[model samples]
Target: MRSVLDRGLALYRQGEDLPAEELAKCTALAVQLAERGERIAPLLHAWDVGCSVAVAACWVSARPGEQSELVSLTQWSSVGVKEITAAISLAYVHAQKQAGLDTSRRVLADLMLNGSATDELAAAAHHSPAKEYVAVAGRVVGENVPSAATVARASAALTTGDLGLSCQAGRHLCILAPIRSHRSTEELSGHMVETLKRVGITFAAPAGAVIAPRSELAMAVQQASRIESLAGIAGLDGKTVESSQVISELAISRDGEYRRQLISLIDPIVEAPELLKTLRTLYLMDLDRSRTARRLNVARRTLTYRLERIEQLTGINPVRTRGILAFVLALAARDLDLSSSVPEGV
Candidate 1:
């Protein structure tokens, strides 16, 4: 298997028409080996099929008349050749700007609805070196197109820390990301983009769009804050959990006096304009001083000096393990508090 992967990769790196053909052959062979009751079959097959499809699609697109040959090549390549071949056919139609988009979309839709077994096969093929590549297929053809209300429901489900709902939301979002990107980013940001499209959200890569596990509570707080008609919105409101109150309680419960002490210690430094900017960047960059320095376009030593000054002014070491935790929580608190003050649904 290792030899098979090495051969395929080597062919890929060689970079020529012949190499592409040879790589396709090697990938097909890798897929065969993956299916021979190998434990890592899923991963190997994923890479094998992805590379083969990608290369063959490119080749066929460049030489549109060789459609039959492309079909034949894919048919002989693997057991699930029909689906792969269909993908190639669609890719060709898409490239040629032919009337096959609707046809291809319908085929894909059917495959997603009735092809769970194929998805599992693809998942198996996505097992190792191929895992990442196979996921591309799984994300594309396996995902269901959820509605906008489904997205909102999924978001709401996430509020309860229900892992299943979170997963459902994540999967739906992953699909939505790519569809949105197709109009915006490019043809190939892969499965991650697809997932986002399904969920109907666009996220810039550098924006760190991944929802942290711990952030679910924060999401719930944000959602609750959006109920304008809730009595909590009026000053004489009925009793309900204020989002800031929730955050403050959670923060205090997690750290007690240590949390408050840390906030007090850091507040004065944050009041200093220059120091606040540095700390803000540091937190945003997850305390990667080098990245913070890069974002600030300051020398690393200067960043260090700024951090040191923060610690000096506040009597708290930013680098200390406890200090870092406290700082992040404090920042979360500040964000929650500020968000709570905004009118609901804004």
Candidate 2:
């Protein structure tokens, strides 16, 4: 049998020419997937773009000799045609649920990336009135990322009545959902994590999420992405990590320039494995010089010399609160493995 997306759109006629039954299949499948905890955003998004192209093709195909306008815009490739047809199938599905709801371009673009939601997205992005909003960003370990619409649909199932939206956004699976007034972010976050796990999600790292006001959904997303990374590094693999759980890392991470400065302080030490180990161990042991020396199995004088050398090179003494904070933050940043990808944004 032809896929739900391609079963129709054949023998192109005109925009909205696709049959109601064929289009309805896409909608039915979307709802079904959402109910069963599958991702649907990417699938619907594919449908959106695909259908838009298909209609454009149908419009041009009907024009025939008057195709000059259509020719410039379309590449006329087989893949391009297939994509547009899929989109038509997707749009028809939406038309089924919301009648004339277009989802608009703004919603589609936002869903295609891992970021926050802006006020503009509310119109077509399924905004609902709720006391809390949680934005999720997750990626499967390999190429087997679930279809977009399938993931989105899965997210919606969590709403259990409240307004929710979920979808595959680029490499991440995302959700924008509301919280009941009685539900705490921790409860919601933990529940979502467990739910995703129960559904057998094959994420490389567990999902990351942030719950906040609608106005900060975008920043929440960025924070969630980082929390996911930090959790992975902290050995909390395959568990949902929320922003509230990592306050210090979140604070240290916010300043792009300050993070760089902290990292710079450790660069000179990095070249010397012994010195790196010394300072890292010192900080890791909570400034216990005796314990650090004993763990390294070095004499007191040797430990003293290494500390002096670290101070000489970085000019930051580990004994001082400010200096130790900087040292620990730098290593924590390294431990989180964000030394490179962090600067690029979520």
Candidate 3:
């Protein structure tokens, strides 16, 4: 089998033609391994090692000082490695079917990794690649990490009809659900939080966003993960936030220069702790002057005076519509650690 792989690789290097028989043998080997309950990772690793050896030998056996031939070998071997891996994947899927094993997990993994797989396999898994999905991800904090059964039970409890697949990787749990089924991502997020709480697991700061399509579940998961991180930075723990609500803040959270520039909006009054507190409280109170004043233990008139002073110092009103947006973003950027010491009197 190893010799077969080497021969196929060499033939490809020499003539850019992959031998059909060699690929068939690889497929057969993968099927056999799958049927025997052997993992595909080790088999793939062995194939990788075999490819490395063949490539090295080909390079060494090149004619003396044959730089062009060596370069060609490198390129061809790279292509061979990918083709062989794909072949193995298809073969393993075939083996799973022949053995009457559930291939849904494998199908999901393939989609997550490559964003696409054979349409037939996807159909078998009931995960149509053409459909759109919403990805909800949350960080599982504390020692009581939910077990696989716990995760499944919680997911089943929260979702109905077509339940999307849930993947738990270490401290992170991501679920990709059909968009049509779950119209409101926030509702889905709330369901997740509630169900997780019932399982003795604290789902901290779950975040969600609509992804492009079922094939892009991985990207959606990544987006949800980023949202969760941003929520944490903003001290929004135990809250379920949709990306759309904080899209601008999320964008600013990514760029250091933008964060610094936005945070600088409040630099003029950073030294005045009282004014800063007032501004933060105003926003937190949803710009309700009466509530903000009560929270700050100040009279409404005092709160009014602080807002005027804030506008005078920073040139941006903390209560007006446009000014409110800018100040909120600046506060978010600062909370995300874009802090700098503005001179005391600036």
What tens digits encode model 3's per-residue C-alpha lDDT throughout 1-346? 5777677766755675777887788889878876875556556656668878877887777787887877877887787667677667777777877897654454344345344345555555555444776666676665334455555554554444444555553346766665666346666556656665776656655454456576566666666766766666666644477777667767776687998998899999999999999999988888888999999999999989999999999988777899998998888888776433111110
Global lDDT for candidate 3? 0.67
List CA RMSD, all candidates.
19.7, 9.7, 7.4
Give the range of the ten consecutive residues with the poorest summed lDDT in model 1.
128-137
Q: Model 2, 94-183: lDDT tens per residue?
A: 443454333333243344332223333443444554546777777765544657544644554544454356555455666665686677
Question: How well does candidate 2 score on lDDT at residue 83?
Answer: 46
TM-score of each: 0.30, 0.53, 0.64
Model 3 has how many clashing residue pairs?
0
Q: Which stretches of candidate 1 lie over 4 Å from their true place?
A: 1-262, 341-346
In what order do the candidates fall by TM-score, top score first?
3, 2, 1
- Which pairs of residues collide in model 3? none
Alpha carbon lDDT of each predicted model: 0.40, 0.60, 0.67
Q: What is the lDDT of candidate 1?
A: 0.40
